[model samples]
Target: MRRDDLYITVPSLFRCPISLDVMKSPVSLCTGVTYDRASIQRWLDSGNNTCPATMQVLQSKEFVPNRTLQRLIQIWSDSVARRQLDAESAAANLSVVPSQEQVKVLVKQLDNNCYSSLEKIVSFAKESEENREFLATMDGFLDTVFDFMRNADSDIKLIEQVVKILDLILSKVSEKKPLLESSCLSTILLVLQRGSLDSQIQSVRLLESIAAVGGESKLKLAEKEGLLTELVKSISKDKDPRLIEASLSCLIAITMPKRVKTKLIQFRTIPELKNLISEPNTSVSTIEKSLKLLETLSSCKEGKAEIWHDSVLLQAVVQKVLKVSSKTTEHAVTILWVVCYLFRDEKAQEAVVSSNGMTKFLLLMQSNCSPAVRQMSADLLKIFRVNSKSCLSSYDTKTTHIMPF
Candidate 1:
């Protein structure tokens, strides 16, 4: 467990071929093939008699412990643990403004134990804004980051660490846009798809920074394969609120392109957005963001058709009006107006009406919402009134009403 060994990549020999993860218990079958005991046992229990890597049918199933490889794995595991402790220690030792010499030592360690060094740097950066500004101005720090991005190919762990570091300080680094080559973008997309939750959030924030450059960089991000898909996928599932907010923020930042909106629709972003808006305990900011994006999506023809037909989604959008902030009400009203009032979709109008949406519109008009929102609410009320076969007088303007369908 020498200090230098901590910098080296985990030996391929130490990894189980079946799982490609580091083997905890190395064992060998009679065919002279080694495997992690658990992985091989699972294979054997599943009725496989052939060697997984070599594919030779096994004449014998008895296996013995590879104590030598086991010992090596233990040593490697211990060294990694020590490196993590050292990284935490190094990050803790830095002052309010880390001195140049201390920064230099950490930067130098990047060529060795990059995972640990990155942990140290990100830990320190997270401590305070002044520390982030200090690190951004520190010479050679950006160079190290660019080098990692350029060389990052299949090392997911390294890529995850580097993306987290970049997300923290890229905004403060002035020369950032020029340094973002296509490979760096590809690396970011990879992390967005497969990295841990923290890495995914960092990837989303980094994409936001790139999109903010405005022009070719933004266009390039919008066009990257799997970038938009992954972004949509992040919100399509129930995730940590922070990741959802970051993904939503990034989507809002990059959706200026019409095709981006279309692609988002193709990826089924609307229904997930409906789920978000419908969730009772969702934060006000998240609901606002969800409505804003949904409002943007409702502008296109397919978006209109999508919202026009899904009654439940329409109900969710209707529920947001006057139920959240004024901004949410505004976005909600605009979306409803486009699908129901402007386009004159009967089903869309009915969905809103059926969800007590008539009352929401009634309340929105009375509230001091934006003039446009009030106007739209007024218009929407007219649409419902004109189309209603139900008893409209049951909708009490002074209080709640049970709409008799």
Candidate 2:
């Protein structure tokens, strides 16, 4: 095949399933599956014991180099490289790509708030992957955009655009210092509170990104001035799934801190999360997140009281255990275990048993759940059985113990 044609239509067999790129070196696993060496090595390094393409558990980590496939790929790659060089030479004469100096100038224009400069910079960054990487490497570029948002006063449109640009820039840059600043965080919270819906979505997305990078410190900053409360309220009120997802993500990030978990309970986040979970047409992810948050909140006394106080919510949680994904099942079961083991509230225990929670627990033990989940299910079932017998025998005079209704 011609080199240019190879670029246009490389054989599917030449591509690594994991990287979805033309393979440089092919290796065969014990499963007799071929994959790119680097991609499979990284996958194995990440502790994966299953074939990425076949989803079959690997019998061994050993990989045999496929020299024949490697040679074929090398020959094809050489031909394609030669054609790419010729094409690049031809395109170089027809086009004038922006220089690093020119991009720096656009970056300066962004700092000065030059007319249409933000739009131009955003356009340039989005023009190609190379441009995005170049912009990311520009010193102080992310900080300048962050400062623009922080200093934005009366210009809502300007703030919105800056946030939009920040979102794009964040996707390219891994730097976290600019995003962790107090002024930048306050600006993002303000946007979440007062900006338009689109801007609010962008701001929440930016907050999620910051939380991912900032870890515990950023989470502490997020809890300031009832920001976490506002996030829960947004999740409860926003009809947009995207916005709700972002808000939940931010909440999840901050709730990692124990103090923040207690603070979220103080914010009465459980009721709102319960409402969100009960909402019709809610996505599984939203429901899963709500349950996960509840799992965290339930670790505290206030959270347990709040969850048990609402029988409907307790029943809903029981129903969610085996009904959703395994992760969701884990979270739901953990919450139940916490409440049942720590508090040992008879009413709550009775509520769960009556809701067929016992049956669900048994089903989960037999189903595909994590060992921890099954163990919790067993513990809960044992507790429920003991509690039911205690309840029955405590009232009845007979020697026989009957299950509680």
Candidate 3:
């Protein structure tokens, strides 16, 4: 057992009051105190007339079998056992390192329906960076994977494995154009919409890789019917933070096109982003990406107008300032600066002031925030200070809060 498992808390009710351990055989004495059979038997044999737990004299020396408690304890123990087994199995799979001969054999045996061999190759690829590079360099590995992908349409299990393997080795593979083919795009779209969470994450990352190869390829990807919709839909679904981050990454890569940005807004990406960043359990990385995506959306006139009108979103953006990592702080500050400082939206400025955003700006000015951020901070502070008629500008500000130019 791992050291951590030693600290796993067993349910108190499942434990023997006398032994302080999970009851192997729970029995209740006449006093209605349940104890492990062995422990209570020893107590009774010691000529004790009282129950160890209750300190009450037994009406009868006989103990009744507690079948219900015993069964409950058994179920709890079995679940813990299964959980430990699954953890051990996963760890074992991660630690397995296959040799080059083993990888080559698996690649040779690969076919459209050969899920096991492909799964093994994927496992090997995931074992280490060295294994991925080695697989990428293999003579027939790419050819075999491509052939399998061609005939594996709608075979979600096969496609999930194939996509994962490809994603693992994609960077090492020199030529990425084949992934842009019609059949391959269809497979990627299918996985994005229907595959398991892991597969969906891989599919989005695959799209990110393809989009990185700019020019006509990026344009072609952006123009794929229903492609942008699915990517935006993934963000709105908010299924997993990993999926949200991956989808945001892909959208950031491909959304340089104005049409794509418009479509994303039409799909309600902004509202979804609002809900995501507002969530307390959201990871810092996801929050950073969410803010970055929001900043991207705010660059457009329509997007800026939409964000400016959502008071809750503006407040959420304000709350993120200096709350998480510096990257998130920067993104959050930039979004605020755009709507409040650049565009001079009164409602947004009031929202910021109401959310204690001025304090964040004051602190940011004196901190190690970047010059651009500092400048934006200065601009926001000026926006509030200069509006003498607004009630928010009445707060006391020390000279130190505003850096001298």
In order, the Cα lDDT scores of the candidates are 0.80, 0.74, 0.81
Candidate 3, superposed: residue stretches over 4 Å from native: 1-98, 152-154, 387-405
Candidates by TM-score, descending order = 3, 1, 2
Better of 2 and 3 by TM-score: 3
**Model 3 C-alpha lDDT per residue in residues 117-201, reported as the tens digit of each score:** 8777877887789999998988877877776566635478988989999999999988888877877787888888899877899
Pairwise lDDT winner, candidates 2 and 3: 3
Residue 342, model 1: Cα distance from true site in angstroms = 2.2
Compose the digit string of candidate 1's lDDT tens values, residues 1-405.
345656578889998999988886789998898999999999999999999999999999999988778777766777786686687567566534445466679898888877877777777787778878988998878877887787747589988888877888888887867545777788888888789876899899998888888767767887777788788878853466778899999998888777888888998999889888887657899999998898888888888999999999988887777777878887888898889877899988878888998877777666788766666666678777644544343443321121110
- Candidate 1: worst 10 consecutive residues by lDDT? 396-405
Clashes of 2: 0
RMSD of each: 12.1, 17.7, 13.9
Give candidate 3's whole-model lDDT: 0.81
lDDT of 2 by residue, 1-405 (tens): 333563686878899999989886689999888998889999999999999989999989999978778667766766776677687556544555556687688777764655466666656664677777877778888677767766736366777767877777677786766666667777777788888876898888877777777566666565567567678778863345677887888788767766787777877788788877775557789888888888878876778888877888888888887775777788888888878755788878888988999888878767878767766776777777645543233333221232110
Candidate order by decreasing lDDT: 3, 1, 2
